[model samples]
Every structure is written in structure tokens, then in C-alpha cells.
Target: TKTFVEVQQRLDDVNSKLHETVSGAREIKSFVTELDELEKFDQVNDNYMKANIKVHKLMSLLDPAIVLISNLAIAAVLLVSSYLASIYTGEDKVQLVGNIAAYISYLQQIILSLMLLSMIAMFVSRGEVSARRINLVLRTVINITNPENAIKPGIIGEIEFKNVSFSYNNVNENDDKLTLNNLNFKIPKNSIVGIIGSTGSGKTSLVQLIPRLYDVTSGEVLIDGVNVKEIDLEYLRKNISYVTQEAIIFSGTIDSNIRQGKVDATKEEIEKAAKLAVADEFIEKFEAGYKSPVNQGGANLSGGQKQRLALARALVRKPKILILDDSVSAVDAKSEALIKDNLRTLKDMTVLIIAQKITSIKDADYIIVLNNTGGLDGFGTHEELLETSEVYKEIYNSQLGGYHE
Candidate 1:
């Protein structure tokens, strides 16, 4: 919020400055105020703090360097020309020396100009160096690894995690403890598995392993009986469609963003998927229908609209496995019910929904409830867990306390 307000103020100042420039009035006050506002905005990112300070220091010294270089060059030229004229016309050389001296004044201006050009060239070299350094930082790889001779796995959507253990940077401890401790699990050929947990219960991390977003520290993640690391990375990802809490939308016609799921998907298929996700009603109301240009990150759309659109994009693919990581949290209860209702009839597709809301997955065939300490607290259906699992009962009690008479 602070960043947004600061940027808005800076933008308004910039607009006023632009108007001043166009009207032939170069207000020094406007430029200074704009520069100060920009400095405040830069503090928000802190991306170039060190480089900015160094650049400012260099700028302070640049004028003196230019003056010294100019003075030295002029002194050299004047000394040389004065000596030459004196040697050529001994006491009668006043007029000749004066003419040469007047021309020698231009020599200082030429030297200053050359110094300015050199400074510009130095700035260009620094810019290229800075660009190379930035590229080097960006090139550092994390989880993405593309292997040669990668073969595609068979069409079975069986997911298996074998003793998978994961850890992050050991800021406090010298050793890395497992966030998912010696975990072993398997999803059958065609079954919807619901993963329920409190916030930061390693739900996201566990699912991320199947997609190879993050590799297991000690074990293997398998899809379709083949380890994900050994399978063709592209083909493995192509068979799975994932949606998360934050819906990523691009700026373009709604049709274009949905096409990213399956580039060659027919219009009929797109419309069908939209209908299934209950996004058709709102989309049809737009003047351009599917062609309505969505703003970047779907800023032009409501949270519910973005979530539904993302769901529709996921459904359009008709992948072997649908991994939804709290994807419907933003949608309204009615919309969520409609989409879930449609999902009941889907066959041959394995759906894995990771959710925090117990009401969302109460009817799921299998619910794996996770505790805050990164271990499975319970695993069963809503009624099954309520009867047999204490953790599931607590979650149910917490979310639907009033409903319980």
C-alpha cells in the first residue's frame, strides 16, 4: 500500500513536469521535486541501493575531473604555441602571438568536448558491465533441470512419493531437518485426493514435488510409475495441470489466456470448459465475450472472476491429473458449489485438491489432514474422519462451530 501511494504521487508529479516541458517552461523546482519523489520510490525496491550511492559519488567528482582535464590540455597547447611564435618572430611577434593565442582559446573548448565524449564512452562501458552482472545473477538456476534422452512416461496418472524429505536454508540450525519427514504416499489410477492442512503445513511443498518444482532432498517423486526426474520434463508437465491460490492472468483477450492451456483447443471446447467452471455467465455478459481484453494480472477482473477463469483454464486442458492448490479460495460459495458440482461427473481424471477450508473438501472421497508440525494428523472422508480422527474433528469444529447443535 505504501509503495502504491508513493508511486501514484510520483506519477502525478511526472505528469505536471511533462506539462511544464511541453509549455516551454523548464521549472527547476519541478525537476528537483520529481527527483526526490523518485528517490523515495526507489527505496521501496532497494534493488540498486549500493550502485545508486556509488553513482551519486561518481557524479559529484565528474565536474572537477572535466575541469582539470580541460585546463591541462589548454595549458599544454598555449605553452607550445607561445614558444613557437616567440622563436619565429623575436620582439616583433606581439600581433602574431595574439592571433595564435586567440585561436589557442578554441583549443580549450575542443579539449573539454573530447573529455565529455570520453566520459560518455566510459558511462556506456559501465552500463554494459551492469547489464552483464544483472544477467549473471538472473542466470543462477534453482529447481529447473532439463535432461537429455528424456522419455515420456505412460498415460497412467498414478502419483507416488517415496520417503520424500525436504528442507530449506538452515538459518538457525547447522543441520537440515525434513519438513516432510520420511513421507510415503500413493494416489490410485483415478481418485480425487483432498489434502487439508493449516497454513504453512507443507501442503504446497508436497504437491510441488510431483511437478518437479522442487526435488526431494532424499527420496523420489513418481508419476505414472516413472520417477518425475527421469521422465521427459516437458511431457511430464504437459500431463498435469496445476492451479494455485494466486491466479495468474495475462493482459489480452480472455480467449488468449485460456488458449495457453491448450493452444489448439477448439472454441467449442473452450466454451464447454468455461461452462463447467461456471465462468460462462459473467464472460458472456462482456461486450466482446471471450475477446474482452483482460488487464495485466487480471486487475480488471474481480477475485472471483479470476479464480473461475483460472479454474476454466485448468479444466480446458483435461489433463490426466488436476492439482488444485487452494484454487477456489477466491470464488464465492455459490460459484464454488457449482464448480464442485460439475467436477463430480468427471471421470478418468485424478483430482488432487489442497485446501484449508474443511467445508470445501467435506465431501471428498479421501481427505489427508495435516497438522502444523508437518505430519499427517488424519486421513479419511468427512464422516469417517469426524468419527475416527481427532484432528479432523477439531478442524470441523473450528470451521463449522455454529452449525453443530
Candidate 2:
């Protein structure tokens, strides 16, 4: 059983390595680590092979050894009975021989049952180990759920964070562990808000709260004067569409990918959304156009193209609140500008864009500048932030060479 467990672990490690190399093939090749990756995989595979051989050798010897001992015991019984029979009288010797035959038959049955029990015990031990692992996954709890008396809102696309703070771990006792600290901001209906921050500034954490992905440790998040916790979880998420930095493109046609946002969307609506994201230009170049097949993870398309397609998917939803979480970072300035310009047509949608580049969000109606401590340093137009926020000004100067009028 111990050898069996070792083999199982080694087999899992080998499988993990295989998946990592296959999924990260491009990265491995670009870094010129083909030989290194091959060596790592070979090592893992060899470990699995050795472990498997050890388990098989032990198991194979067990049954044969049991049979050898049982045969030897029967031979000893026969030899002793024969010696006893020689010392007995005629009728007594015959009776003694008959008794020895019956004893031998009973001993054979006992040995056979014991051998069967041993095999069953070995398999049961392996099964028990696997069952414990499966039970752990099944017993895991999901922390987020709809609150009591949840309201299905008739709300406008407004958002507010009132004295909000959050952390992935328990921050109720120690506030110092907060990822976002006392973030206070309100976005009116149909407004555009830009959020800019350095790495680890909790930019993603802030936007995630609006969708109730993680409940705040302290304070509240409100939409249109009503607390988000009171709102129906499903309704709140349905009205919001979030596009992340990494584009997830499934294996299917272009139409199917964008239609994931709205399953019942018309073909024309898909095309319109693609045009808005500037994805239509390259898409039309394909011989199949909307019907063009996409490889898994958008392997067939360039990084910029994948970003544009993902943007189109979000736009097609026409959700009340749209979030672009650095979704256009891979695109060139010309294409990114066009997508931003096209977004202006959605006058009734509240949009939040998280960006690393000032050129991407400087023109936003309200730009949120976050410092290293997850505190808002500025919340105003680009011109206003240039005077109020040193962080914003420094970023603007570095990216654009200087702040423009």
C-alpha cells in the first residue's frame, strides 16, 4: 500500500508537468528552454516509471509467496500422518489415513480464504486513500451567497464605495491586512471612471467588489442609493460585464465567441460590437469572416487581436456597467484610441477602465489615482489630477514626456 501511494503521487506529478509544458509552449520556446523543459519532464516521467515498477514487483511476489508457504504446510502434514499410520494396527492405520485426507482438505480451504482476504485488503487500502482526497473537494464551502431578503433592483448605473475596506483573508480583527483601505468614491449614472495604480495597488480588488465577488470587510458598497448586499446577487452580476487583462478565447467560430456575452444576440449586433472594438477590420480579412474558426486560447490570433475580440464580447452584452480591466493593453495606440472613442457612444452605460498607460485613461471624465497603500490620491479630470496628485503627474510626464494643456 505504501508503494502504491508513492506511485500515485509520482504519476500526478508527471501529469502536472505535461500540462504545464503543453499550455506554456510559446513561453518555453521564446526563452530558449526547450532542452531544459525536456530534461525536467524526463526526470518526472522517470520517477513515475520507477515507482510503478516497485509497486508491481512487490505485488507480484506476494501471491506466489503465500502459495509456496501453503504448499509446504500441506507437505509437512502428509509426512507426519504417514509416519503415524506406520505405527498403527491394520484397521487403525486405514482410519488414520482417512482422517489425514479430511484434515488436509480443511487446511487447503483455510489457506485459499486467507489469500483472497489479503488481496482484497490491499485494494481496499488504495481505495481508501483516493476516497479521502475526493471527500475534501466535495466538502469545500463557497463563502459568497445571496443575502436575506435580497432586492431585485430597478436601479440606474450608479456606484459608490463608502468607507470600504477589504482583504482576501480575515481582516475583521486586523485592519492592517486590508488590500483596499477606506476607498470612498461615487460614480453617477452613465459616467466614465478611469482607475490607475502601480502594481499591488488593489486596482482589481476595487472593481471586483462592485460585482460582490468578495464582500467588504468593513463599510458598504452601494448602487443607486441601495446597498449591494441587499441587491439580488444574480441581478447585480447580470447587469455588469467585466473584461480582464488576459483574454479568454474559446475554440469556436468568431460569432460564437462574441455571442457568449449575449446568447440571443443577432449576427448584426455581433458585427457592430466587433466594429466598435476595431476587431472587425482583421476579422473581415479572414475568408470565413464571422464564421472563421478560432483555435483554443486564441492561439490562431495575435495578442492585440485577442484583446479586441474580448472587448467586443463585453460590448455585445450592452450591460449597464462595463469594466475594461486593462483589456486593451496589447493593442497599438491607434486601435486603442478608436475603441475608446467608440465607447463614448454608450451614453447610458457606466464604464470603469483600469489602465497602466495615461494615454488610455487621461481623457476619462473622472480618473482615480491610487497610491501604493491602496488609498485614492486623486479623483478628477486629467487636468485637475495634474495639479492635485503628484503620482498622477509623474506618470503622465513619464508616459507623454510632459503634461499637455
Highest lDDT against the true fold, candidate: 2
**Runs with alpha carbons beyond 4 Å of true place in candidate 1:** 1-57, 60-69, 76-114, 125-129, 170-177, 402-405
Per-residue lDDT tens digits for candidate 2, residues 1-405, read 677778778988999999999999989999999999999999999999999888778778878988898888899999999899779998998899789889889888988997998788778877876777788899989788888899998868999989988888866624677788888988988988999988998999999999888889888999998988899999998889999889999999999999999999998899999999999999999999999999999999999999999999998988889999999999998998899899998868999999999878878889998988888888899889999998898888887888765
Instruction: Give the TM-scores of the predictions, in the order they appear.
Output: 0.77, 0.89
Please, what are the lDDT tens digits per residue for candidate 1 over residues 197-316? Answer: 778778988888887877777778888778888887888888888998799998998898888889999999999889988999899999999999999889799988998898889889
Provide the lDDT at 46 for model 1: 52
